[model samples]
Target: MRYTSEHKQATRQRIIEAAGRRFKQDGIDGSGVATLMKDAGLTNGAFYAHFASKDDLVANVVADQLREQRASFDSTPSGRAGVEEFVRRYLSVEHRDSPESGCPSAALLDEIVRCTQATKEAFTDGALGVIDEISAGLAPGDPQSVRAQVIAAFALMIGTLQLARALADQQLADQILEQGVQNTLALLPAEDRG
Candidate 1:
């Protein structure tokens, strides 16, 4: 029997959500279509009905995950305080320990570097949207003026989290997280440093 359009859309969303979590937990190359389908509680044969290929799913997941991240930042108080809150939370031990629910860029950047052009483009768009959100927080009146600072600071946060996760020592990881928060906040304008 044919599924309703609503059912089809819901199934597609389910697949994307599962793929997002699985991809972050296990690198994209580590996650096969069969495993991803199983994670979504759907049969492997049902994969094609929603996505054309693994590349398509990866691109969709990248966009969805980053969009969610941006929206989350949007919920915080605006201005310098918002940016600081984001940095602290992003580089926190909780975020460090939970790769599956953390930033997609931190979890999948290495794998994303080798993904298809379509996937890369999706990442680019999503990343820019996230940057824009942070930039707005830095400069509510003129985000473009502070765009460079936001990009650099955000990059540091992603890298710091990635490095912290790679290390086996939890104490060192926590130290790195603390330093990351300080350094990232320093990148902001002196006037906004408060």
Candidate 2:
């Protein structure tokens, strides 16, 4: 039987959502097509009807996840206060422990570096959009310098989350998260009081 266009789009959305979680939890290279199909409640034979290959899915999934993330941050205020809220929430223990729903950059960046050029480009575009959003919180100053600061903070966030997730000791993990929150707050451009 042939599927309707709505059915096809729904199937594609299901595949992408499951792939994002699987990629975060198991790494893109680690997740098998069979497993991804199973997670999506579809048959192995049906996989090709949606995505051309795993690389295509990887590129699309990263773009989708990061786009959703950027939208989530849109409501946050733009200033030192905004960056502090971002740091606290992003570096929290809960965020560190939940790779499935957490930032794709922290969970899959290492793996993304080795993906096809199309996937790499998707990741880069997503990451840059996030950095631009965070840069909005920086104080008025040289655009170049403020942007540099926000980009560095974004790096520190991804790195700290990755490191905390890798550590075995919870105490040390909490410290790692807290230190990132503390340090990033300090580096944020102070609000003008005049």
Clashing pairs in 2: none
Q: Scored by Cα lDDT, where does model 1 land?
A: 0.93
Give per-candidate clash totals: 0, 0
Kindly report the root-mean-square deviation of model 2 from the true structure over all alpha carbons. 2.3
lDDT of 1 at 151: 90
**Number of the top candidate by TM-score?**
1
lDDT (Cα, tens digit) per residue for candidate 2, span 1-194:
99999999999999999999999999998999999999999899999998899999999999999988888787777666666777898999999989998899999999988999999999889988887777654543444556777788888899999999999999999999999988776666666211
Candidate 1 runs further than 4 Å off: 191-194
lDDT of 1 by residue, 119-184 (tens): 999999999999998887777778888989989998999999999999999999999999999999
The lDDT of each candidate is 0.93, 0.86
Consecutive 10-residue window with the lowest summed lDDT within model 2: 136-145
